[model samples]
Target: MRTALRRRLLPAAAVFLLAALPACSSSSSDSGSGSGSDAAKATESGWSFTDDLGKTVKLDKAPTRIAGVNDQIVPLMNYGLEPVASWGYSSIKDDARFDDLDTSGVKQVGTAYGEIDLEELAAQRPDVIVSEVYPTDEKGTIDESQPDYGFKDLDQQKQIEAIAPVITIKLGGDGADVVERTTEFAEALGADAKTVAEAKERYETASAALTKAAKDNPVTVTSLYADTDGVSVAKAEDDPALNLYAGLGVKFFEPKPKGYYWGNYSWENAGQIGGDMWLLQQAGYDTAQLKKQPTVADDAALAAGQVHPWVSAALDYVSQADYMEQLAGWITDTKPLDD
Candidate 1:
């Protein structure tokens, strides 16, 4: 889930019409009838990408001065493409997902999603902006009328699109959705093929490991932002990684997305949420901190220490593999706390 500040702890991003996307892409899937965009193609004359909205973006040369949302930028960096500027939700600054990657020289134009220092982004002079698209409803529909997942709206999208072409990568069903699409885009942008290939190999291994662990364990999990006041449980349908994890046979607690991206519950009532295990934020909200909550002392998962950190990594095979590897360990080791 793209955590948002709807409550106090979670963070969300800015979206736009002509927006941004992620990096590290392989060959694009052949366009199905009515898919609305052509497959991304590169040639000596120029480069072109069919963005998430089915818009084909053409440029005279592959863009080097890349700038866009941090979620995507980090993956591009994994593939050896450095972005000039990046803006998005607060996750860029403090999330564990971006912990190891050094974003030293990259200009931060936005601290919160949708909020950006236009002048600061403009100062970087990016050649292209990349962002993502998300589903609007439960059925995984990518409505073009909805704003792209990195900028605020059509107005904000146009304001930035005036600076350069915006390439959007949609957050799709499985972990590989954005990773594969980003690989195609990154390759088009001249990312190293060897590095991308190696990353893909690691990803395949981790994915297999996760599948085996999940199939063997059969433990249901719940992912949430557990705060002092309440918990905001993530809706798997809204998170690309969780969707992938589910496909691998991880049984996530099915919560109706009643709020923005999750279902809300008070700390007093949090224990009522059912799951064999819990996927939680890594730091600050530790067992000690959670014990401060009313029901944490009695919660089965908490008592059993059946909690693991949640990771929404950069949509690249490298990062995805790392997270999946970690997740597989947790699943393989954890005993079910619930029936």
Candidate 2:
């Protein structure tokens, strides 16, 4: 972790989205995201999987050309699936989340919210199109399902579904179960078992190291995302990845979230909670501007230079391993608040 917690703007091709740490309002684990039963069942080159929405996609033969939203395409690529096209917050070429994977030949049809080049995606002739959903109500808790979080509306979802059987999965929980379930999906998609196994081992190893660090240097960690809109104090217990960290012995700055995943407040009221460690969003949070707020200006963590840039890890073994190792190192370096 850099002491300054520096993060520069991404390239013009890259775009930002609020979908990061996609929240779940339901207090129960995995409620915000869909159930964990969406596994790929393969039989003699045929494929079938039940999506989070309870929709079942059965293809007579496994689709050779797979397409997914930006968030999921990278993980499948790591699993040895070559995507023909992608649509998401950022193109694969510019998305930092895919920095570890080679996305040289994939086509990007969408780069921002509520926009997708359907014709362009159709040109790819994908066998199956995949997407992740975190359907939530206005209050930000899980509610009636949305067709596709990436598309503009129900019409767009219908158009895409017309082109190929869309396999949608709900993502939530402490992060471990989703990884395991998705591995089953990748395997069904014909992912190389050796590669997947190797990555899983690394993930487990990193998680163990994180658990050790949390026990050695105990500190209550706070997660924050700030911009011109306002400050959001994330309910660590509500966020799947943060909750996973909590289960690993790391104490989070647990506060009652008024909304789904966060408690929104004006900058004036931003410093409502105190913590030994502060993890700010790497991309959007503006700490320099936040100093204008009296409460944030006097925040002990900021004054002590204990702020760290938090990377929103992708939901995969590779991404999780990197994030965990980095976080574990930071936890080891962080001192207790009382110190």
Candidate 3:
């Protein structure tokens, strides 16, 4: 009777041990699965973004020390992302493009064209660099040889990149598209969402008003930049300001063949590009000097004061809205030119 009892107890113990072995194996599998999930979350939370160049930039954490080109800085600021340092362009004072920006605490990395103070920029210890990338080919490749907004030329690009990751936004999109992309970039940098939303709302409202005004008073408009040497008639579709005007119902003057951004015309024949009104690119020439030119002075639109300021590179929505409002007011105030 004792031998039979021992045999039954031994079999029961073996069965219990087998059951415990499966439970331990299941626990190990669950632990491994949990570790993989944690790693995925860690990757998701890390700082990583794909720039316009299609390069993925990564950092240990979200960047705080940011730098940008002057033209790029104002838009970032409008979205509530302030930069620590900026290069390209000059002081915002008296510049219409930067009229809405405040650059009080930001350090100027470079003030002149094709010049960057690398020592000054490096001293800022920027976590990231922001700028506009202009495409050179149909494949949308950046022209590294050409000067970008943040750096004067490609010569200092490596040094700048060595300091921090460079994030570039493509510059050729329309006004609304640009605003959307800029908002996305700013949000990625931890800008206040509510503030960016408010700004976007304001822009849309202003844009609607301008469109209505433009529809009410339809007219032909042309954009030109003139100097003593020659005049460059802007390709309306290529320039942001002119594109906005075209979107608002104004008929743009298209040059013959219609591919290039600017059609170069001698000062003698500048007036031949006919339009009911003219939008002047107000750089490298003064108002008085422009008015003094025979071709510009003799043009019916110029003579009638139907000329408005056009910033080809205007980026910020507020600045674009302000410019559109001014254009709308001009359209409302002036009589359409006789055909």
Candidate 4:
């Protein structure tokens, strides 16, 4: 699963919307008539759409044989694209939201993060592949300091396209906006208008609840990453993380360099990286060891307990809704009141 802040994480400008759309996109199996309005609708008709790479490929004319390579089952499920093949079943295994799936019928490939074995992916021959954006050092930037994982945002996705056209949706933001990304994919796949409308309505409902929750108590945002070396907080200024929070009008402790995941601050620079509320993404280790690290323990937010560990590890794919709910609660639940 990916982690992105709920607010302040969109591209500097609005992303371009796909051009064609049927009026009421719904998720339905094309019946025998195939000649009815279902087939007549121009927008929700095929999977041979342009990918993030801007290449046009036809995988499905309303793909029935779908493979979900990335971690975005909910949207595809909502879009009515059932996975004939998956990286693994772990993501849907635990969540109640995906009770509709039947794992016995689907092929289990592997994990979502690593490079796919082209031979294996080709063998499945899915009509469409949906993927999630890989985590970067920060938006539009790379973490040069960490060389082993250069951490390029779209690197793995570029390779997926060589197999088939793929749509990369950034996680982190008001969950509703993810539908827009879904719509783009649907247009590519010829998704039904009813599906797009339903997804949009779902997003609108979630956004409204978040808006009310913010009015009840504003949220503060933060991002964290932990590996064997230590924990580093993100100071992001764009897509998924910051953008999600911005959508809710929540505030977070701002970091230096203005735009990046929370910066790497040492003991000397710790004072500057503070926030009224803090959310952390802790590595799975003895909590005591994390508390000993100055970066994890000595920080002001950690001291006061205004910090909560945001959970993304349990999920197979992180969607906009997942990020919004996790971070929104992390921020709101930790709100500091005047004592």
Q: In each prediction, how many residue pairs overlap at the backbone (N, C-alpha, C within less than 3 A)?
A: 23, 0, 0, 38
- lDDT tens per residue, model 1, 227-298: 656777877756778877787778899765375457878776676787878898552367678877777667
At residue 148, candidate 4 shows an lDDT of: 14
Return whichever of 3 and 4 wins on lDDT: 3
Model 4 has a clash total of 38
Clashes of 2: 0
* Candidate 1, residue 198: lDDT: 93
Which stretches of candidate 1 lie above 4 Å from their native place? 1-38, 91-95, 142-146, 256-261, 266-268, 282-286
The TM-score, computed over Cα atoms with residue i paired to residue i, of candidate 1 is 0.82
Local accuracy of candidate 4 as per-residue lDDT tens digits, 1-339? 123221111111222222322222223232321222332233455433333222344432555556664345555555655566666223446544456555555665654334344455546665556655433544333332321111123444444444444433444333334445545555445556776666556555655666666667764555554445444456444434345556666665455644344455544444455565655554333445546766557655666677665543212122445555655565556656323
- Sequence-dependent TM-score of model 2: 0.84
- Cα lDDT tens digits, model 2, 181-265, are 6666677677898999999999999999999999988888888777776666677655667767887888888655476566677
Off by over 4 Å in 3: 1-45, 137-141, 144-147, 257-259
Model 2 ranges with Cα > 4 A deviation: 1-38, 135-142
Candidates 2 and 3 compared: the better one by lDDT is: 2
lDDT of each: 0.72, 0.69, 0.63, 0.47
The candidate with the higher lDDT, 2 or 4, is 2
For model 4 the TM-score comes to: 0.63
| Model 3 per-residue lDDT at 75 | 73
After the best TM-score superposition of candidate 3, give how far the Cα of residue 308 lies from its true spot, in angstroms: 1.7
Please state the error at residue 29 of candidate 3 in Å. Answer: 34
Clashing pairs in 2: none
